[model samples]
Structure formats: C-alpha cells, structure tokens
Target: MLNSCKLQSRNGSKPIVKQASFLTHANILLRCHRQAASRLGRCACIRAKLEQAEVATQKTKDEVVVERVSSTGGSRKAFAKAFTAILGLKLAKPEDLDPETLLNPPFPRYQVPGSDLAVQKLRPYFFNRTYTDTDVGYLAFFAAMHLVAVIGGPLTFSWEALEVCLAGYVLTGMLGISVSYHRQLSHKSFRCVKPLEYFLAYCGALAFEGDPVEWSKMHRWHHMHSDTTADRHSPRDGVWHSHMGWLFDESLNSTRRDANGNMKDSLSPPWFYKESPEFYSWLRATYMYHQIGQAAFFFALGGVPYLVWGFVIRVLLTMHMTWLVNSAVHIWGEQRYVSNDNSRNNWIVGLLVFGDGGFGVKLRIICQCRQHIPRHHNNHHAFEYSAAHGLEWWEIDMSYYFIRGLELLGLAWDVRRPSPSQLVAKRIPPSPSAGASR
Candidate 1:
C-alpha cells in the first residue's frame, strides 16, 4: 500500500513542473514581440520626420528657383547653370512664365469674388449701373468736374490759370497724396508731431482721393493682396479696372465677409484711425463738403478760371496721375526686386505722378522742386516698411526727401528704412564669379 501512494505523488509532481515551464516560455515570447513592435514604431516615427524635413527643403529649393527666374528675367537658360551650381537642384525643362503663379496665394481669410459679378463685365459708357445713391452722386460730381476740365481748360488757357493748376498739383498731388496719404498715413513709415500729421492728412484730403482713414485702409489692402484676385486694383484684372473702373465699383465700399459670414479684419482701419476714431469718422462724414468748399473758394478767388484751373483741372490731373500709378506702373516698368506682385519701377508714370525726375533730367532740377517726386514703385513693394523707395542714389524720391526734411526739423522721427544687410539679403545672388569678387 505504501509503494502505490508514492507512485501517485511522483506522477502529480511531474505534470505540475511541465505546466510551470510552459507558462514561463509563453511570457518570454510575448515580451520579445512587444519589444520588436516598439522598435518598428520608433523607426516609422523617425522616417516620417525625415520625410517632412525633405519636403520642406524641396519646397524652399523650388521657391529659390522661382525667385531666381523672376529677379533675373530673360530665358531660363541664362540663369539655369548658376542656379544649379548654387542650389544643387537638378534643372528641369523651363516652364512658361505665368504672372499669376508669381503672386502669392490669397489670404486664407480672403474670399474670391465670383466671376459673374457685374464689376467683372465692365460695360462701356458707365452703363453697367450698379451704383448706390451715394455712388451715383460721386459719379455725377466726378463727371461734372471732368467735363468742365476738358471743355473749359483750353477755352480758358491763360498763364495765370496754368500757374494755378501747377501750384495745386504740387500742393495736393505731391504733399497730400504722395507724402501724406501714401508714405505717412498708409505705410506709417515715419512719425510726425500730431499737428504736422493732421496738416498733412488735411492736405491729402484736399486731393479728393478719400478721407485719410479710408484711403489708407484701401492702400493697405492693396499691399496685403497685391496682384492676387483679392487685390482691389491689380492690373491683372484689366488696366481700366485698376485705373478708374474700380472707383465706380460699389462693392468696394465695405470690408468683405469670409466663409463664416464674419467680416475680414485683414483690412481693419489703420492705427491712426483706431487711435482717433472720432476724428477720422468726422473727416469721412465731411469729406464731400470739403471738396465743395474748395470749389467755392477757388471760384470766389479767381472766378471761372480759378474754378477750372485750380479745382477742376487740378483734381482731374491728380486723379488721372494717381490712377496711372495703379495702372501704368504695374503694366510697364522694370522689376528691380523679386516681390510677389507685378509692381514695376515705371519712371514715366513716376515722372507724371510722383514728380520723379525723367531721363537725362539734372539732379539740381529735382532739388529745386521743379520735378520733385517719388519713383521706384517696385522698391516700395519690395520694402513696404521702408520710408525711402529710391534705393539707388540717382533714383530720386521727393517723398522721402520730404520725410527727411521733416526729420531735420524735429517734426518726424522713427523713420523706417531697409538696412544695407537687408538690401543685400533681398537681392538676387550674382553669378559665381561676381559673388566671389564681392
């Protein structure tokens, strides 16, 4: 009986030991599998990061190539060898240049206007007719002024009338539009004492572009979305659309809404307007009255001649010249910098509008206030914050000179400009030999 009991105990112990060994082997296998999975996950994460970095690098390389093509101009082969040597990118077949591609994509918040809009059709003889009551009034006023200028200008051709027209052109076109509305108000390139600032703004108002706040807002928007479909006055749309057709488009009266039905704050009122809302509001409300008052004063001062020459012809000339800045400059002109938009350094437009000294004109004449003006519209686009548009010494900018004069008088400060390093950084890289020489 004792031998039988011993045998049973031994058998049970053998099975128990085998079960314990099997459990140990299963745990070891599970741990190894988990570790292998962990390593694979780590490798995948690393690969993803590397791919992202490569994509970013490739995108940067593409942009550099595009900028090279834009800045250098001419056949792609002209810069292809230099570009490849510099960037180590394989040169592919050159693609045809598309101006639209050169421009930046529209702001994420911007909604493109539909093609079916009446403004796009642009009917002749002002017959498209989408004007609100206020727009109609504006159209009528502008029409009347234009008629008087065209009809009465030659009829009342006197040296005195011509002198008055030229004087008004200098005061309102140069001081008001270029110095005040453009450089000072729109760009905030320089600071002035409040009195001087207000005086400059009032001078701009006399040009009859719009109130200071509204004009600056529109200009800022232009810079923000230049050459894109969102641009308010891009020549890509049409020369006439950029020039004077935009003025009649009533859709430009207010800020555009986004997909969510919220007004886009991208074109919010300028800092000056936010700082002094009441003043700008009053200025906007009383803008038309100021023009009317000026007309009355001109009539009272020198009768019909003063009205035609000082107010009528002056406004007409200023309007067309300013419009040409939006039209001719973009269409013609040379591109000195690789800006996203198609802004050009149109010397002829600059001569007429900004009083830029024309070809072969002496610098002395520029300083004497004979042809004092702004030039280098592309430079303005390239360096938006710069108070000085004329980067080169010979490229005279009277607007910048005005700002400098104000600074000398202690009336302007905090004037902004591109440093030498910044200018070099933005410039297109020269050929390898030229770069080595530098």
Candidate 2:
C-alpha cells in the first residue's frame, strides 16, 4: 500500500500536495534560522565594540590616576630635597628641583624660596617683577575704589542709601556675576536671547569684574587647570593670591596674550564675544566709565549718601563676596564629590553669594521663605557643564532657578545637564558600612 501511495504522489495526488507543503515549510524554517544567526552575529559584534570602548575609557582613567600620583610623588621628593638643602644638610642644586614644585610647595612653610612674596622681597629671586602698564592701572583703580568705600561709607549714611545698596547687590551680584558671567558666559550652560544676554552682561560690567570675555576666559582656565599650577585663583597659591592678588599678576595676562596683544586662540573668547566682538570690546574699553557714570548718577540722586552706599559700599561688598567664592569656598566646606580640586559646598559662602544653604531647620525655613537657590560648588567642579549645580533637593541653586525662569519664559534655551545615568556613573560609591546602614 505505501508503494502504491508513493507512485500516486509522483502522479500528482493528495500525497504529492502534502509532501510539497512539508518541503516549503522546511525551507522557510531554514531561512528564519539564517536570519536569526545573522542578527546574533551583528549583536555580538556590537557588544565587542562596546566592551573595547569601555576598556579604553577605563584605561584612560587609570592613566590619569597614575600621572597624578607620579606628579605628586615627584613634587614631594623635590620638596624634601629642597628642605634638606635649605638646612645645609644636603647640596641639592636649585635647578634639579622642579620649578613649579619650588614655587608651589606641597606643604606650607615660611620663606618658600620661589614664592610670589619671596620673589618680591628676597634678593635676586624675581620671576616677573616688571609690572605692565595695565597692571599699574588696575592696581591704582582698585586702590582708589577701596579707599573711597572704606572712608566714605561711614561718613555718609542714610536708609535710602542702604536700600539702594541692597538692590544693586542683588542685581549685580546674583544676576550679573553668578548667572551671566559664571554660568552663561564661562560655561555656556544655557543660552538666552541676544538682547537679554547683552543686558545681563551690562549688569555684570557694573559688578566691576572683568568684561565678559576676559572674565570667562580666566574662569575657563581655572576650571581647566583647577588647583594645578595653571589655576589663576586656586587656594593652593595662598588665600589672598586666589582672592585678589591674581588681579595684579600681569604675567597671567602676558601668557594669555599673543605677540600682537590679541587673546590667544587657545584661550578662546566666550560665545557672546564671538557673536558680537565689537560690543564686548567696547565694554572692555569703557567698563570703568560705566562705573563712573553709575557713581555720578547715585551722587545726583541723593548726594554723598547715595554715592557712598549705592556705588562705593555696594561695589566693595560685591567684590569681596565674589572673591570669597575663589578663596573661602575652596578653603572650607564639605566635599560631596571627588572633583580633583579643593572645591567645597560652603554654606556661609553659598548663603552670601548664591543663596545656597545646608541641612538645618533655620536654613530650610530661610530657603523656603526667600526661595534662595544655592550653588553646590563641589557639584559644579564635578560636572562643569551642568547648568544646575545643585544635585540634591536641599542644594538650592538660585542661579539655576533664574536660568530655569528664563527657559520657561522662552528667553533661554539649550540648557544643559547631566543625565541621571551619567550622574550615577560619576558619583562616588558609598563605603560598605554606609551602604549597609542605608
């Protein structure tokens, strides 16, 4: 019977139809299997590439660590040798020690041989003693301002003057220095319409910090080489040096300028400058005039009292508070992240400068009442590009809030922030005990 059925299938019967259907199904399965294998192969290749990239990234991180350790070890050795030579116990040559290491000793000691003070006071140790004309002008200008603020402030007093001082503090300090100069210009954390951006830059000019271009360049340099020898305002270079002494250091200006007196391309100008060079250049040239005009206006409005409080006192306060960010915040406060620098989340500096506070009932109440946002300085160092420096809810960032307000109003866009995953990746892992307790 089987032989008869096979013969019938060969002659095109129902058995033939069934046999053809089974063959077609087998061909389909084979094709499907081949497609699946191809997809698996592609997935495996992608996975391999990802693993390679991860390995490379990890290697780079390890290399950075090794380099840092090697640099630190070399600095320490140089310091030890220098100290021994200073004591006359060893005859180590000055040239043998790293020049930077000599200038910036690992530990604090009196009479550091190559320090700025030593260069100034000690015989035959000058590195950059010849101050530029620009340097002299800056010193004289700042001195005059300080003298006026100190002498005139107490002499002229009025309630209206105090109110004016407070208003200018908020306008120039918070809006100008923090928001416009630091976040917008230096970091480009967010973008606003040109008119608003220029207006903010004008306000920042009133703060008497450098023009937007110069200020942003210095700030960028600080971030790029933070706490290293290149940092313009690192606390490692002495508290006063970081606070205000750098302003008089003309060598820094020389380094950033080319033979033609143009800012080096490497230290590129900020977006605002690139967008409108003439405008910022004009501001740079006439920024002092703006301050003078402001003083005159205040004098006209309420005589000596307004001039003292609104211009002199306000400028002094703003200057010191902003300088403290470069000094106090780096020297004090809690380190929330490993940013490879001495940046800290200082409550006092934060409260005064950016309105950031810490974990306390009083602080929380004040933050809520005033809606004052705080700058988490450590977070900022860790993620320099992040628009919002306050990573945690308690780390209220007023500058970020102002940017957020602009964003909502369609005046700001392209606001940048680290993703949740990126934040997690950058965060330091908790210790075993802490993790267990949590």
Candidate 3:
C-alpha cells in the first residue's frame, strides 16, 4: 500500500522520508560554509561587512551535507500540498494553521462562536499550565521522599549533603543534556571527539527525558517548522502549548516521515538510531535501569537522604529547569536578528542553561560582519542545521566557551567559527544597542 502522499516527491522519484535522515550532516556542512564564508573569527569587531553569496558557490563536497529543507519549511504550505493530494491525511495547510488554531480550532466548527465561544475560550484554559507531569513527577517524587522522611525519620542532618544534588544536577543537566548532548552532540554547534561526545550522550540519558534518539528527533522538528502550525512546541502558539504540554500530547509531537514515507533516521543520534535501533534500545534501557538501580544502591550505602535529595528532588528540578529553556528562553529574550518566531536572548536563561548552549556564541561570530558574520538564529529557524546564532560580542554566550574548551583539550576538533566577511551578511545595524551584553 505505497499510496503516494503529500510528503512524497510529486513526480514520485523517491520518498522524501529517505531525505530526512541526512538532515544533520547536511546542516553541519552548510554551517561550515556559512562560517568559513563569513570569516567571523577573524580579527575585527561589530557590524562586520556582510558577504552575501550563494551557499552553492562552495564545493559540492562541502555543500553535500546540508540538504534541501522541504522547499515548504515544515509549514502549512508543506502540509497543504500533502493534505490535498492524500485525501484523508489531516495535514494542516498554511492558511488553516494560525497561532490561534491550537488554542481554538476554528475548523472543529465553533458553531456557537457567539454563545460564550465555550471551546475557544476554554481551550487555552484546558491545558495544564502549572507543573506538568514531568514537572509533577519531579516534585511529587521529592514530596514523596519528604513524606517518607517524616515517616521513616532518617538520622542525617547536614546542609553539605544537600549540595550533592545541586552539583550533580547542575553538572549533568547543564553540561550533559543542555550543553553536550542536545546542543553540541545533537546540533553540532561545535565539534567534539568521540569520548566527549559519548559522555555527553550518556549524561543526557541520565537526565531521564527519554533517549537520545527521541530528544534529537523532537529538537530537529522544532527547528524544521519553528513558528508554523506544524512546529511541535512553539510558544507562538501559547505558553502552555510550548512548555512541556507537547510531550504529553501526541498531536504536538512530530510525525517522523513526510507524505513520502521517508523516515528521519539521519536526524537521530549517530550510530544509535541509524546503524542499530537495537543499540539505542539497549542504551535507553540501561540508562533507565541504572538511574533507578544506582539510587537504591546509594540508599543502601549512603542513606535515604542521599536518595531523597540526590535522586528524587534533584531529578525533578533538573528536568523542569532544562525544559524551561524551551518554554521560557524563546518567549522571553530580545530578538537580535529578526528571524521568525519568538526566539530571543535571555541572559538568565543562558546562565541557567550553560550559555544558552552555544547558539548565542556561534551567532556572535556570524553577526560581527567585519571580523565575524552574523548567524542570526532567526535565520536558523528559517534554516535549522546552520551552526551560527548571530550574536554580537557585547552579548555573552557560554556554550561556545565550553566547546572551545573541548577543542583545547583535544576532545573536540573541526570546531567551526565564522569569518569576517560572512558576519557582514548576517549582521543587523546597531540600534539603540538593545541586546544582551556579557
């Protein structure tokens, strides 16, 4: 039953599903070109000369990595083309998809638009805006531990003991998931060697969000559509929808294949998703198992407080905080490059999530326009795989610093930064100078 769908090649050469896998490789290579072309890291500062050139001018070998983002950009345009051709497929078309649609599905036929508009008015309230399940799961676990504490009365009293939870959560969640795993490993914002890369992925799993495959897949989708109706979790839709609500609801999740039945394996973690689902399963299960198993061991060896603060509360806080970036950063910060969507630069967010995981730093090089070209993360939403964020020097970004450290340690190589001329094209003229300054 290979019914050709909207995602399928209209001419039917091959399923676009096949094209999804190389998204990462394609993105990285394109980023390299953008950086090399810009010369952002060269010797200069602020408003570098913009070098506008066809990304194709680079050698084929170099350009081969960045693929043709659906000419439709995971939007309703892409969705419509698929929907009309496929009869029953419920792909939302561009016109059909608006920021308000999620909160009030006009098509569900709000018959009594006047009579209280029950569904539409109520829809926004319908979502769980407060601490989500993952949030609840986190807090509940900690509360349960507290109750257990009062019930069992463990004999341990020391504030220093509590510090382990702080250190561990900060180290792993910040360095591991946000920085190493999601940002560097999955996105390739900067380079890293196998050892560091593997460690990053490992700690990411320890965060217990899911597995690497799942995390990266969802992240790629976010970049693919960004603000459009198809965007998995866009704040533009609403704060509740963007936060963690998407994780619980299937509708907000990404569909792996296009109308063509092509799978998005390439966007998945290296080797784990592509070479062997079996290995990924093993990694996923093992990470889950030891996370629980180790806690029990710690309880037996160290005591219940170790388990309560170190495991339960720490996990609960860590996850929600990590997710806050998705829910908060994009919606709160100031937009330096005017790409689309609500993405912005929140300094507290960067501090909270390890320099906003390097995007800002990479952008700084791209936006300089003299020594560095602007990356314009707004441009990134337009084109996700490109590695620059288009931030300026006055703006501070930490993720890039850590990546640089990896390079210094020889744990990472092929570290790309923009050149001078390339920065120019990505630059925006200094306004009242209303952005973050490090």
**Over 4 Å off, model 2:** 1-131, 252-265, 355-375, 430-438
| CA lDDT scores, all candidates in order | 0.68, 0.69, 0.52
- Candidate 1, backbone clash total: 1
lDDT (Cα, tens digit) per residue for candidate 3, span 363-426: 5465653322222334334334333342455444455556667778877776666566655654
Residue-level lDDT of model 1, residues 150-172, one tens digit each, is 89999887899889989999889
The residue-by-residue lDDT of candidate 2 on 1-438, one tens digit each, is: 898888877676776789999999999999999999999999999999999999878865543332210122223223334444454553312222334644554544443233322211111122425543334555666788789888888788778889999999989998998888888888988999988988998999898775676678778877777766566566666666777877665455334333344332345446676578677766766665677789899889999899889988898899999888887677766666678877776767777776432221234465444322334777788888878877766666777889999999999999998888877877766568655653
TM agreement with the true structure for every prediction: 0.64, 0.65, 0.57
Worst 10 residues of 3 by lDDT: 113-122
Ranking by TM-score: 2, 1, 3
Best by lDDT: 2
Total clashes in model 3, counting residue pairs 3 or more apart in sequence or in different chains: 48
Any idea what lDDT model 1 has?
0.68
Q: In model 1, what lDDT does residue 145 have?
A: 81
RMSD of 2: 13.8
Which candidate, 2 or 3, has the higher lDDT? 2
